[model samples]
Target: MNKNKSEHTKDDNYLKHVSQIDQVNFLNFRRYLIDWYETVKRDLPWRKNQDPYKVWVSEIMLQQTQVDTVIPYFDRFIKQFPTPAALANAEEDQVLKAWEGLGYYSRARNLHAAVKEVAASYGGQVPVDKEELKSLKGIGPYTLGAIMSIAYNQPEPAVDGNVMRVLSRVFIIEEDIKKVKTRHIFEALVRRLIDQKRPSDFNQGLMELGALICKPTKPLCEECPLQSICLAHQQKIETTLPVKSKAKKQKKLNYYVAVIESPEGKILIEKRPSEGLLANLYQFPMIEQTKTDCSLLSEYLSAEYDTNLNQEQMLEPVKHVFSHLIWSIDAVKFMAQASFIPKEHQRWVDKKELGDLAFPVPHQKVLRQI
Candidate 1:
């Protein structure tokens, strides 16, 4: 099938518009964006210095997390692990504990591994070379761009969601931002537009503009500095410009969470497998089942641990949503028979010791019920 005449014309016009962002316009963009950023950019903790270690840690924590939520965590984490060597020398459990309540436990795990590499190989210095930085675990293109431009003041583009939305509107790009190819397109555009003298400010300005003014919903277009140049605003389509495809529906699973306690008042907890979802985290022993039937739970306890559920009582259900899945957990409390023996990867944790272990948020919800 061929595009109709109007569609062809629209495509031609978009290309022309993109091409029209010449050097003069690029200079103007930098002036407006950076000037605005210098005046109004939020005074984030990480912005205090160009330390690559702090930048790397903050960027990792900021992934899939909001800025406001990350502030305290960043402060506490930096206070605890002041240097790459500090984080590298710390135990994985300590890192996870500091990262507790921050979802995506894998980020903490990967950061720990990467920082250890930095300590061992780079003598506690974050690699300044692009290839060397990319060699570290969990450092992808965006993170690499951020470190190079922000920490090293190199001319690189840190194209994140905010930058994509801002640029897509400024040039009227219609590519689906969710696509990997679309990201490449945006990165190329940034490479062309970035200011060599002020790459840090330029990249951060785009992020600030999108976050503060070019928001996903109810964009403050009138307040935007780029209002005069934004093709989406000129066309009265600012809200509709950055085309994004809907994500796939999250798969849902149900489980029966056992909040069993011994007569000595120790809670039963088990370590999850060392890989996969919520890896290496601790949780109350749970069994996957369709229904929340105590009899089924009782049978499971009897079969697996040779334990009987005494004084069984149902607690409130807990629902946790993950990026790709949902957990609908039905929690129940019971006293295990005194003769029960702990299985491998399982333990009876005293209430005070629970704080020392890292449990994922869903299990944390179950803990609150007890």
Candidate 2:
């Protein structure tokens, strides 16, 4: 027997239970979910209109970010770049400034690229065709599904973590949701169960239900609309149904961040390379080391910039954790001994100009030491 086939067969057995729910119960499930959504859905800005641009922006910002944090950012971003044309016309630095605090810079970068394409090729309108939408950078399966169903009223499934949790509980699925195959399984189930007439509401309802009721911990089962039909709830295993494998441990790296101020009251900062971690963002001059060593920072400054650290003082360390890496930063403060010629990627900016330039969260913490 094929190992992959055996695993698929195991998953199919769980799906069979879902298919056995019959048309009438599926209708009831949809009715219960959509009715509850319409009644209690939170007043979010993106929900106000089915404008594909707004939906796309909100979806990208919301990924790996909380709604409460994204709301203000979304509001500010929309106000700044009201249309695809507006965003496409703006400078990358300006776009990054608007997205300053949002952790995932690549999302903003890719969205900017995609919006530029939208303005140039699609006449500032997000493409409606699935194939056309998929061609755009950062328009992954979940995002494509969201734009299609929520914006264009297509019957595509937006099966995110929330939807998976809700579905796994309702159908009592035991598959490890971390696997790619499990997502496909959930997508198939959604295609079958999704309300054709109100695909938008159906998709949003599942997401909302998972967020508010089918929570990862301490789910409010009594208040859930799907409680009547939830197999996991009936079996008293709602919390345990959505099985997910543990993520790999984040690798930790040490760095010495140098905060050097010139005699002219200009702060020295450098732009990260165009690609890789924290791409194209401004940060204090920093050097990665295997271990914490302040002397290495001095040597780096002398060699790289031909300047020595004067009035050197250690500042409070900053610890920033990314999805895959943890940065254990040792922040050092000093004044420039002499003005040296700045490199192409290095700049000396006054306080006001420094404030305007976008710095990633880690560098922002270092800046606070000044």
Candidate 3:
């Protein structure tokens, strides 16, 4: 009985907090945001249409990537995979090739898999219903809400980091935004504040406000449409309201890269394992070290390639940071003996052929230098 009472009281408190937002105030909030969005939204390619396939591709590209970076890639990808059927029919390498340099290769793989299902099952049209949309692989709550609201104009709330930041500042929510529980609170608030008539505009407006005005630091509170009613701004604590815990330190690793060029001037590249980091991407052969060192490269080349490799030059170290790991790569140029043979997953390619193969950004950088 005591436990039930405690749970009920907690739910009551949550409801009470949300109830503080009156109907009139909520309407005014929505009105101001929609009005502001109409005047000042970014002229994005995806925003020009209500096509769900375009929206889905743009959203996936925008995950952990910036808008400016996504625009060209989105354009090129759509041109290549104009429909679900196009992506479904295309080879995996072709899909990854289109998505090269975007990072998070898994998103590309999942999108490919999901689009194949969409082509076969949904007849190349993105599903309209929320539950059906959720059933697709890689389509989570946020993506589902975004597609439903933006493309379908449903009264679904697209609560991403931008939306969370905007709401946390507007409501003066002091809860840690990093916690999974906190997202539910923000989602509920969005449900209350979402404009029924223009769900797409309203959701986009909130995200736009966060991206342009209610920023992480030195927020342009004066420019925000919600400035008048924003709790954080009203309390003069806008910069400090949406508190998020810092992420864990990335594990540092050292990789000694071997750029082996055969006597005929073709470079040796290998395909990464089908699983794990940089899966199925092409790169020069490499040996990881406990710390930054180049002595192991000679021995590794002899044992792995069964050839004597003369290290021509040791270039400057290159750093590539992922979400959870930092790669400190030392690229070494080596000349493979003429008798060297290409092993499994390894092939010799000229510069033109290298361009055709999809190499991760770090490898691309080193290739340019070599």
**Which is the leading candidate under lDDT?**
2
lDDT by residue for model 1 (121-164), tens:
99999999988999999999999999999999998879899999
Q: TM per model?
A: 0.93, 0.93, 0.93
Backbone clash numbers for all candidates listed:
0, 0, 0
How big is the RMSD of model 2?
4.0
Q: What's the CA RMSD for each of the models?
A: 5.7, 4.0, 3.7
lDDT for residue 14 in candidate 2, whole number 0-100: 46
Error of 3 at 49 (Å): 1.5
Candidate 3's error at 75, in angstroms? 1.1
Ordered from best to worst lDDT, the candidate numbers read 2, 1, 3
Inter-residue clash pairs, candidate 1: none
User: How far off is residue 35 in model 1, in Å?
Assistant: 0.6
Question: In model 2, what are the clashing residue pairs, if there are any?
Answer: none
Instruction: State the lDDT of candidate 2 residue by residue for 229-336, as single tens digits.
Output: 888888898878799999999999888888888888888889999999889999988888754357666776776788876747999999999999999988888788
